[model samples]
Target chain A: MARALAISAIVAVFLAAPFAAPSYYVGLLTKMLIYALFAMSLDLMIGYAGLASLGHAAFFGLGGYTMALLLMRAHASAWIAFPAGLVAATLGGAVFALLALRARGSYFLMITLALAQVVWGIAFGWRTLTGGDDGLPGIKRPVFLISFADQTPFYYLVATLVGLSALAMWAVTRSPYGLALRGIRDSETRMRAMGFNVWRHQFAAMAISAFFAGLAGCLFVYNNRFVSPDALHVVTSAEGLIMVIAGGAGTLFGPALGAGVIIFLEDFISSHTQRWLLVLGVIYVATTLFAPRGIVGLWTDFSTRKRKP
Target chain B: MAISTTLRRTLRAGLAAMVCAGLPLAGAGAQTKTPIKIGFIVPTTGGFAPSGEECVTGAKMYLESIHYEVAGRKIELIVEDSQGKPDVGLTKAQKLVERDGAQMIMGIVSSAVALAINDYARDKKVPFIITCDAGANELTMPGPLANPYLVRTSQNGRTPSAAAADFMVKKGWKNIAVLASDYAGGFDTIGGFADALCRLGGKVTQEQYPPLNTTDFGPYATNLDRKADAVAMFLPGGGGLRFIKQFVELGLKDKLPVMDIYAQSVYEPFLPQLGDSAIGIYSTLHYASPIKSPMNDAFVKAYFARVKHQPSDNAPDGWVGAKAFGDAAAAVGGNVENAPKFIEALKAVKFDSPKGPIALDKYGQVIQSMYVRQTEKAGDGYVNSVVATYPNIDQFWPLTFEQYESYKYRYAELKGSLTDCAKVLEKK
Candidate 1:
């Protein structure tokens, strides 16, 4: 009951965030929520299911452009478009998993990168469909009963969806299928011997992860009222990977909190100093050197150490 | 198209779900008929922010002069940062039109962004008053799908490039090497200059196309045919920031008088970045506030006061473009749908800009006076000192379709490509 109450309070604060904040703050929070949603999806794969996805933005962009092209050409509604986007992302994720399940470690990472690049090329080279390097413009986004006419309302809508998606992910991860996937991650060879089709479990993990990432992309488009080829670029993929690493990769809520704080810090720092990138690079290097387990892990260590003392 | 039952069910379900989710109905009523919103996308918050920042200031000054209110209606200039990316610019332009309720649009620094915006505006039916970005006249032209609302104030890549090249040609410089960025604007201006110089029987001894932000111009300078009579190049904004400074550092300024196609690329504001060495370079431009115009005098005084720095060739152009948009707004009397009438009024329009007189062509390109300016030291230290004026530079570049097609100039039917492009300028 206490946790449930805490969850509701979190949702309320997130929804009200942009309204009370300035435009830049609103934009930052909106991105944070979308990224948080994306991070949660990654946590399901990496944490619960034992699959790692570095090329997640491919799914994100797939979902983004699905909605983008639908509205750009066919005038599709966001209500209908978001799910279609999710399905598209899921299919993309499945294809990726099929290619990647045969490999492990560095090879898996390489295959994922190559696949994401292929998707990015499609977004870039196919100008007639995706506006090439230009990107799909004049896309009308659907919200829950009111079309998002501005950034603030869009923030609220995205915040709501992100929360719901997180809850959905939380529920799924706590279920038996999620447990089996986690078991597979812990010992894929053992799980295969235990009469479980480990490949299928990993595949399913990827599909579900892709769905939420795509949903995040869809909400991102809604928040920004724009989509670009930058959506599919490697830097974006790296950003998600960075968020996961910084927040403690295998922790469920950790990725979300990390995504939020990190993005907020980026927004604040970049705005304050143009050399924020240099500063961030220095800090990232320091963090890796001293606290390889990341912020949450380090905090946990501190609490345990203090209690022992 | 044949649809399966699942597809039909899904589409229908999606539609129903959207209704539940609250998709707003199209053609929604406006809050006010007379509230004018001008959506703008520029290279703000990036490497080009220096230029974008000045353009924004220049636009605001022009808008503020009229109090962002024209014909008793309030004006709202909603600006977005494109960050010098093409996709970002296009998406931002669309949002400004559809969501922010912007009636007209303006400003973009990169040629790639301008090209994207030019196509999008045609479908959206919002008047887009493009100011900067030197992508030639391939954006708008006369046709059924011609962007009726599209108007531009900035000069194209050809005018200045050709003028400088033609001057070099007149000076009997036979063998010239060329250097340009490989992108759309770069290619167009370089190609345009080459065409002009080559037509005058000059040989382009060597050509180099570098990436936009190549801080190292050592290879470019060393590799150049220093023996050539001249070296013509096209570069703008921050790209020009590094190219010329490094070229001079390599002692090319002493050996060869740089006949530059891109004048705005080398401005007075960024002179500090280039240092005292970046002087005496000759380039062609539409306006340099000291070019003997009442508007120029007023603009320079206002701009210098605002920036606390000497204004460059672009400051006047940005201010002039915003004023042109203001003129059209004043003529429209707050009905943006009547923009066709406003455009007709605009065709008949003559505004006192920093460049003297800005005349609209048959296409939207602004026909303006071009000045061959040499950088010099003054009380302000360094500026684009006007050498001579090539008055009323127009779109008709004395080139037949056959002549343009002789070289692989993108597409052959040059007239068909830039069918309706042009309008009038300031980058602001």
Candidate 2:
């Protein structure tokens, strides 16, 4: 009963958010939700699989620009383009996993970082195809037989997709697959000793993460109606990593809460100072020093500790 | 995915769609007649933070005169920083429309962000008056103007770069080499330079497109061994400034004359960064110190008084976009709730900007004058001194049906010869 009410309440809040919030805030929340999906996708690799991939935005933006380029050049329908984007992301992620995931820990991170930069350069240097730094502009929204060119419909479309993606992620986390994933996370050697195909499960989690990120990317391009090389930049992937870690790693709702906090902090600081980055650095540092478990982690720890008594 | 697994995913997707088919439309919600806010998205980080500050300052300056009201109703200015990144830009743009209650957006320094929001402005039915980042001639022609709510106050780099090439072509320079960053801005710079040189019967030895953050121009400098009459370049952002300094330090300036298309932040961002090394380089600009207009004098004075620095090309677009918008809002009796009415009013706008005689093109880009300015030391500081005025230099692409055919046939590098391109001219 509590779980159903919790899920229903989340859906209700999402559906009613735009009406109550200002347009900018609504847009902000939509982006938060979108990035939350991105962070969660990254967490599947970083948190569960223990493979730190900094090349996540390469998949995210490749999915975005791929969807963007196809939506315009191929005149693809959403049904066609969304899956095509996912497939493209999956292919790219598989190659990345093959190359970078073969390594462990810091070496994996470094390889992914280098690979992410290679893709970033391609986005910026391939002028004829990618529009270089100016980026691909004037991409149309998914018609979906209903003109999502309008704001409200587009927002709802994105919200619904985010909700479903979160639900799917939760479902995945509860299945037998989830138990195996946890086994890999807790101890990969233990899983391997138990005669499990540890590499395949890791690969499967990565593929799943890439698919959801690609879906989010598809929504992202539609949301902005444009894509640029900056999407492929390492900073963007880092942002998703920050969101997952800052909100509390290894939690279902952590990335979403982290995205929300970061976005609002950025918006609020930019309102007052031209030097908002300094403010962001300070905030992140303070959070790290004071609340080492992260905001949601702190709450969960406090609540669970109380419950234990 | 494996073939059968992919099939199953596809099949499940179809089933999920079927399950959600009865969802009610989310667009039926009505809008209120409250104050209309315009989201101003610009960079508040990177090397371009000053430009964003100027944009906000200019908008606020104009908004102050109107008492925060447009069309007899209240108006609000919502600000967001793109941080010069697309993903961040998209997020900020979303926040602008959905969180700030903005019906309009203005001020994007990076073309990337502007392009990203171009679709958003259309998707959300919001007006975005771009005050920075000159576009490619292609965008405003029969192309990207697909977004009706989009308008820009800056000319494409093609105009100024072409003019600089024209100046070089007229100089009868025999050989040329081009160096530009490997980006959209670089592509435009290269295109404009090559087009102009080819028109003047000059041949380019080779063109180099370097990475954005390249500090070492030594190899690029050494690559063009063959001597040319002049070297034309397009470098902007933090990269552009570094290139010019390095190019001069390598003694390339002494061998070949350098001309650039860096109007907005180049003057303020780069020139100041280089105290003396900035001398003798030529650039094309929409705003120069010697424009010789009463409106410009007032703006120049007011800017120096406020910011304690001479204004760059950035100041004019913000000032002009803000002033034109303010006038349009007043014309609508300060009521910005009726955005369509404000856009319509701005359509027929003929405001005397600090740059003088600013108006909108068919695509909502400003059809304004441009000038090729030379960098000269004036009282121990570098200033962009106007060398020649190409009053209303037609954007490399044409606006009217007649000019369109002419531009495609006569001028464009990929399409027509320089003579042929010149013949298709909209205005001289």
Candidate 3:
């Protein structure tokens, strides 16, 4: 009952966010939500499936670039462009899975990283198509029944989509397929002995994760109204991983919470000081030392300890 | 069961924290009689951090000169680090305008970042002053990208190189070897040089474009055309440092008369490290520390006292940009809230800056003198000695607006093909 109440309260806050806060904060909140979705999708692979892919931003960038190219160059409608971006991301994820699943453990990480670099190189070097390092700018927000040109309407639109996506992800996590994936994570040999197709399950998880990540990327492009090769860079992938680990892997809510924490902290700290990168580094170090399993893990430990005492 | 409970409690805590954070920040909005806010965005934490710092220092020096007061209003300068990312720059710009209530925005060291913020500044109607090193031509050119809200006080990428081309052709170095970093700025600069040279009856014999921030210049240095009359290069930052070192180490320095296109490669900061290797190398740029002028003398003294070293091209860019803002605000009598009047005042701003006499053209691109300098030893350290001066040079120097616009190709379209520069010259 309390958990239900808490979830409702959080939703209530998001629904009311645009009304209460200034447009700048609303825009920031929108970014936070998009990143939350991105981080949670990565958690499906890292937390649930035990696959630590370092090149996840490739999917994100593919989705964004597809949407941006379609919108800016082809002048496609939002309806067509949005779905096209997701399809591109899904196809990319499927191909990456086919190649990367050949390796497991640390080697899987390395292969994923190499594959993503190939995508990044294309975005960076292809001057005519991708605008090289200059990137494709002046991408306008989509117009539907009503224009999302204003911040408030856009925030509400993003909120509704992200909310629905999160609920779907939560349902997937609670399903029997999720249990089998967790089994594979803990003991692949045991799951295999039980007649489970470990490779097939992991591949499906990869595709699904990529789909959600793609959705996040598309939303992000709309939010920023711009996309660049920076979206595909390794730094973005690393940031996604950090969000998952710092939020507590395997918990759907954990990574989402972690994304919010990181995005907010970055903005808050950078505004106050020029040495924000140094300060952010120190905070990450502290988080690693104090909350190894993440903020969620730390909370669980403290609450359980209190109960025991 | 325990996990769900923990999640609930965590969510509640996060909610409380966010609301608390948002309320205070949003409530602190702008009011009448508040200090005029000027948001300065620069890459304070990336590869361009050093240059960004110098740019900020120059602006701060200018602000200090006027005691930070304009037309009975105190000037509040807010510095935000872009980290050299376009997305980050846009976000910072949005924050500056929407959150901080800045009337004007200034200072971007990276061209990509400047382009990213260009449209945003236009849409927001915030006056953007390009200070530091963002030398993208599209930002100031008359095209789809050109914005009235944006004005570049810094040189366009092609300005210094055009001057260099004119000087090189006059010096009988008709057959030139061109080498620059493989990017938009590099192509723009080299293309300008090649266009001017071709028009002056010179031709480029060889061209090499190394990637930005290239640590190894061994291949490029070894492969440089030894037959050309001179080698013109535009390798900036660390790449320039490395290339010069390797050029000397491989004994290519003596074989070729190298010209530092834009002179940023051999500016004051790199002179001590370059030592004798940079000596006798001719460079073309808008600003050199060794220029003999009353304004330059005072600027050099003030900069050295504050920074403990001679200023580079970036410092002057910052100083000049800030002065334009100050001059415009003073013209409007501190009524910067009147955007149209302020912008008109800004366009008419002309002064003898630390670099030289600077005035904005109708398109808001800077028109100033370009100096052809040589690296000569002064005492123990080195200085860029002005060897030739090209006065009253605009973006389209030596060519009228009609002539420049009549060209079939933009400078960036001539990448890796200096021979095609003849096509541009043909139009003239």
Candidate 4:
């Protein structure tokens, strides 16, 4: 009851953020929520499923491009187009996973990287469809969601969507299927001997992970009102990986908090000094050296130490 | 009673948001007495950082000369880096508009960034003056994306190409070879030039788009048409340097007259490295240092004295934008609150820019002279000396609005392919 009350209070604050905070902060927070959702989805694969796919951005980019083509090209409405985008991203994930699951460990990482490059190549080389290097600009949200024109209403919509996605992820990770995936991560051979369909679970996790990532991508396109090949680049995938690692992989809500840290750090540091890249590097190095388990790990460690004393 | 309480709470939340927003809303509500703030967005930390640095320096030099005051209102310039990405550029633009309270936006070096924010700027009713970025034509051309609030002071992809084609026609060069980087800008530029050349009864014997950043133009050089009078090309960044060096090493510079629209690449910062290899090369641009005019002389003198290095074409682009802003501010009597009136003043704004007599078309694009220059030996190094001039050239040169509209509609479905040459040649 106490936990539920606390969660409701947090939701209330987020709900009122758009109306109570400055407009730019609302914009910044909207970006933070989308990135946090992306990071959490990545954590599902790398942390729980023990699958470190470097080309995760392929799904993200796929979602964005699908949304763009449907709305801009086909002139489809949001309700139909948004779901179609998710379906496209899920199929893309399954297809890439088929090629990726052909190998394991380091080979799996390389295959994922190669597959991502293939997607990037298609996005870059296919000029007629993706607009090549010129990129597709001027994406608009549905007229029903005209609050996107104003910062406040858009922030509320983003917060609600992100909250639901996060809740879904939390529920999935706490389920029995999630436990079996964790068991596979610990010892796949043992889990298989115990009659667990390890490959099926991993594949299912991959599809689910991609669905959430793609949803985040849809929100991203709407937020920025543009789409480009940069969405599909390896740098984007790497950013997700970094967020997962820095946020404390395998911990629910940790990656989300981690996303907030990195985004706010970049925004604040860049505003004060142009050499924000160097500052980010320093913080990353410090995090790796001291907080190996991440910010959540540090908090749990502190709480346990206090209890022991 | 519960609904009324909920409404009151909602009103309070909205009030809080507004109060928080109002804290940083300083420069936004500028009256005649308040200082007008202009937000400058450019790539200061990316591949285009050097170009951004040069543009900022030029703008600063101009601002310092004028003492940064126009019409009794102190002009505050807030600089933000777009990082050459559309997403980053839009975010920075939002920050500038919402937080910095800038009335006008200036200095976009990337076309994607400029186009990405076009709708938002129009919606917000902010007057955006594009300082430097070329390639995309849909920005000013009549289209769904084009907005009246956006004005481009920089060259479009086809402006220089049209001027260059006219220069070639005047020179009586019947056959020309074309080369460009394999990208959108390259295709757009070469296509414009080729079409214009064909329309003028000239022949383009060969055309090639090498993969971007191709270091070895050896195979391409060997395939050059020996019968062609000149080679018209568009190569970007260090690719131009490598191509020119390789062309010189292959002993092709002595044989064929090479020309391009972006003459700044072979001039100034790159000229000394290129040495005499760049000599006699012809190119057309909106501005060149050798142009003989009072405003040009003063700008060049001031820029050279301050920076100690000769200004590239980009310096004049920044200077021209700054001049327009100052003139518009003066016309409005330092009051930027009336956005429609300020936009009208900007449309009527014209001055003797360093690039020569400059004015705006109905579409708010810079209409100015285009200079065809040859790299000739100056006091020490080489300078692009004016060989020919096309005066009062608008964005769509040689084609009237009706003609251009008809042509654009006709070719709207046509991809700018190498096949365009054969089609135009057959028609000729």
Candidate 5:
């Protein structure tokens, strides 16, 4: 009951935030929510499935590029471009899983990383399509979504999309299929022996995770109304992995919290001083030292330790 | 009850800690009246940070001249880092306008960011100026008139390129190779030179668009046509520095005379490090820090005293932007309430800038002189020396406004290839 109440209260705060907060904060929160969605999708692969993929941003960037092309070149509406971006990303994930899942452990990680670099090269070299390093600009929102002119409306739209995506991910993780994923994570051989198609389950999870990451990317491009090579760069992939670890990978809402903390800290700290990178490094070191399992783990440990027998 | 109490205490402590962490270090000093807030955005943390820093220094120098006050009204400048990303640029721009209450906006180090927020600046009805970076001609052309509040005081990408082409053709150099960074601005620079040279009946022996920031230029350099009389190139920022060093190391500089489009390689700060290799290299740009002029001499001296080094191309952009803004403010009697009046004042004003004579054209773009400069030993180090001057140059050079309007693309670089100019022109 407490968990449910906390969840609803958090959502309520985000929903009410646009009306109460300043426009800049509203815009900042909208960006945070999109990043939260990306981080949570990464958590699905790393936490539950025990698959540490470094190329997750490949799907994220592909989603953004796909959406930008559709909107700018094909002149497609938001409804069409948004779903098409998801499908393109899901397919991209499937292809990546086919190549990456063949390997195990460090090999899988390296292969995914290499594959993402290849995508980065394409995005960078293909000037006619991606606008090269300068990036594609002047993306217009759909006529219906033109209400995005106001910060409040745009915030609400992003909140709704992020909320639905998060709820769906949570539901999937708690389902019986989710249990099978946990079993595979613990012992893949045992799961295979128990009549579970472990590979299929892993592949499905990758697809779902990629789909959400791609959705997040679509949201990001539309929100910024521009797309650049930075979206697909290795730094973005590394940042996603950092958010997952910092938020406590196994927990559902932890990654979202981590994303919020990282984004807010970057903005706030960078504003105060030019040496923000050094300060950020110090904060990360402290977090790692104090909360080995992340902030969520720290909270859970504290709560359990205080409970009476 | 004890557990709930502990949780509450922990949460309260966290909340207090966060509030304290988020507080501003020092509050703004009391002002007699609300100062005219100008939000200055620059790429202060990424690849362009050095240039951005120099621009900020130049702007501060301008402020120092007037004691940081304009017509009895204090001027407050808020600086934000764009990180050279369009999204970050837009977000910071919006924050400055929406949250910080900035009446005027200036500075952009990335063309992509400039294009992204052009409409936003228009829609918000804010007086915005592009100072340093962004050479896309569309920014101040037909598109800007729609906004009426937007103007560019920086040199366009094709400024030096066209000047180089005209100079080389006049000197009767027939065969030249074109190389530039592979991007929109790169295309603009190389394409402008190529088209102009070809139109003058000169031959473009080779054309190459090397990827920007490529650490290894071995492949691109070796493949260039070595027999060409010279290579007219545009590689900006750190990439230009690397490319020039590599080209000299490969002995290409000795084989073929090099003419650059005022790249970062030949900029004032890089000249000492570039050493003898950069000497005798012909280049063209709007401003050379060593130009012979009373105003430029004072500006350079002031900049050297403050920065402990020579000013680069970025300083001129900043100095001009601030001067233009100050002149306009003085014209309006420090009252920025009437934005149109302020913009008109800006357009009508003509005066000598640190760069040279500066005045706004009909399209709100700076019409200034483009100098053909050669790198020569000045005192202890090399500096760009003025060789030829194209006076009163506008963004469209040699073409009338109607000719530019009828052109297929806004800029010459959009035509794709040097040979395709006639095709494009015929189609138009």
Candidate 6:
């Protein structure tokens, strides 16, 4: 009952944020939601499947660039461009999975990084199509059933989409397939011995993660109406990793919360001081030292201890 | 449990820290009269930090000169660091306008950042003045990308390069080996040189575009056309510095006379570091510290007093941008809130800048003199000593606007292809 109430309160806060906050803050919130979805998608691999991928931004970038190019260059409707973006990301993810799943642990990490770098190189080097480092700008928001030209309407669209995605992800995490993924995470050899195709499960998880990340990327491009090689950079992939790790890698809500905290802190701290990167570095160090399992881990530990007492 | 308590305490401490930091800013904002806010964005971090710092110092120095007041109203300047990323720049632009309520926005060091925020400033109808760097030609050109709300108070990418091409052709360096960093600004600047050179009956012997921030200049240095008259380069910042050092090391400096298109490699700040290697290197730009003028002397004096060093190329650009803003605001009777009137006033602004007499053309691009500078040792250090001056130069110089715009190709489209430039120039 208490859990239900807490969830409802969180939903209420997100729904009411646009009305309460300024347009700038609302824009930031929209970014936060998109990042949360991105982080959550990453969490599926890192938490449930025990696959540490460093080149996740490749999928994100592919999705964003696809949507941006289609909308800006071809002037395609959002309905066609949006789904095409997901298909592109999914294909990229499937291809990466084929290459990356051949190895395990650190080798897997290296391959993913290399593959993402290739994507980044393309985005950076192909000046004619991608606009090189200057990037492709001037993408207008789609006007479908209702014109989401305004901030409020756009915010509502992002919120509704993000909310639905989060629910679907939650349901995925609780399913038997999630249990099998956890079993593999615990011991992949044991899962293989039990006649389960471990590689197939991992590949599916990766593809699914890429799909959600693509959705987030499409939302992000719309949010800014701009796309650059920065979206495909290793820094972006690293940021997603940090969000997942800092929020609690194993849970859906943890990464979402982590994304919100990091995004807000960065914007807030950067506004206040020029030494914001230093402060952020110190926070990361503290997080690593004190709460090894993340914020969610700390909360769970505290709540259980309180109940016991 | 111990960790959880520690986490709780950390959360509390962070909140306290935020409150402490917020107090002074909150107090500063509680003024009786609402000041005319001008938002300035520059890369205070990342690779472009030095350029960004110079721009900020120059802008602040100008504001200091006016006592932060124009036409009886106080001008409150809000500065944000873009970190040299396009997306970050857009976010900061949004924050400055939507949150901070800045009447006008100015200052950007990267062309990418400028282009990123150009649409935003246009859509919102906010006056954006490009203070330092950010020399994309499309920002001011008569095309689909032309923005009414935007005006560059600095040089276009083509200006200095075009002047360099003219200067080079005059010096009989007809066959040039062109080398530039592979990026938007690089292509635009070097392409301008190629186009102008071709128009003047010169030829590009060979062309090489090394990627931006390339550390290893070994391959590029060795691959240069030995038979060419001179090597024309547009490498900027550290990459430019590294390339020159490597060129000198490889003994190629003696063999090939190097001419910098934008003076990025041989600028005031980089000269001291390059030392004797920088001597006799010719370059072209809008500003040099050693230019003799009363206004320049005053600017150098005040700038030295503030920053304790000679101002670089970007400082004057920032100063001119600020001066333009101040003049426009004053002309509008300090009512910068009157957008249309203020924009009109901005276009009509003309003043003797530290560089030279500056004015805006009909397209809101700066019309000023381009200086041909040669790095020479001055006293104990080095300086970009003025060699020659090309006065009253506009973005489209030599050719009339109609003639220039009649070409099917822009500088970007003509990248690494001097033949294409020649093809376009040959038409009509």
lDDT at position A85, candidate 1: 86
**TM-score, model 2 to reference:** 0.85
Cα lDDT tens digits, model 3, A1-309, are: 999999899989998887788677888888889999999999999999999999999999999999999998899999899999999999999999999998999999999999999999899877768887778888888888899987889988889988998898888878999999999999999999999999999999999999989999899888777788889999899999999988999997899989998887787779888888998898678778777888888888887988998
User: Per-model C-alpha lDDT, please?
Assistant: 0.70, 0.72, 0.87, 0.80, 0.80, 0.87
Clash statistics: count for each candidate:
25, 24, 0, 1, 0, 0
Error of 4 at A74 (Å): 1.4
- The CA lDDT at B212 in model 1 is 64
Q: Tell me the tens digit of each residue's lDDT in model 6 across B270-362.
A: 777899999889999899888999989999999888788888878888889999999999898887877778888999999998999999988
For model 4, how does the per-residue alpha-carbon lDDT over A1-309 read when each residue is reduced to its tens digit?
A: 998998999898898886666678788889989999999999999999999989889888889889988998888988877888789889988998887886888899899889988988887777767777667887777456464556677777778889999999989999999999899999999999999988899999999999999988888888888888778889889988888888899996888988877876666666556677887898788777767777677667766876998
CA RMSD, predictions in order: 10.9, 8.2, 2.9, 5.8, 3.6, 2.6
| Cα shift from native, residue B399, model 3 (Å) | 2.8
TM-score ranking, best first = 6, 3, 5, 4, 2, 1
Clashing pairs in 3: none
Tens-digit lDDT track of model 1 for B1-428? 02123423644674354333222323434544456777777776667777676777778888989888887778887777776766456556755665455777888776557666765666556677777653445554444224666777876667776687677877778788777764445656765666666566666777787766677777888898978987777766466767787787787788887776766455766666666666877777777756776667777888888879866655666677788877776776656656677677656567667777787876677878888887776664677778877777675455543444345443211212221111000011
TM-score of 6: 0.96
Instruction: Name the candidate, 2 or 4, with the larger lDDT value.
Output: 4
Q: Per-residue lDDT of B52-80 in model 4, one digit per residue for the tens? A: 76777777777877899998888888888
Task: Pick the winner on lDDT between candidates 2 and 6.
Answer: 6
Candidate 1 lDDT over residue span A101-167, tens digit each: 8987777888898999999878865544675554554455576687676667776777778878888
By DockQ, highest first, what's the ranking? Answer: 6, 5, 3, 2, 4, 1
DockQ class, candidate 5: acceptable
User: Least lDDT summed over 10 consecutive residues: which range in candidate 1 chain B?
Assistant: B419-428
State the lDDT of candidate 6 residue by residue for A190-292, as single tens digits. 9999998999999999999999999998888887788888899999999999999899998888999899889878877888788889999988888888777
Query: Chain A of candidate 6: what's the TM-score?
Result: 0.98
Could you give candidate 2's per-residue lDDT for residues A245-286 as a string of tens digits? 787777768877787667666756676676788978976786
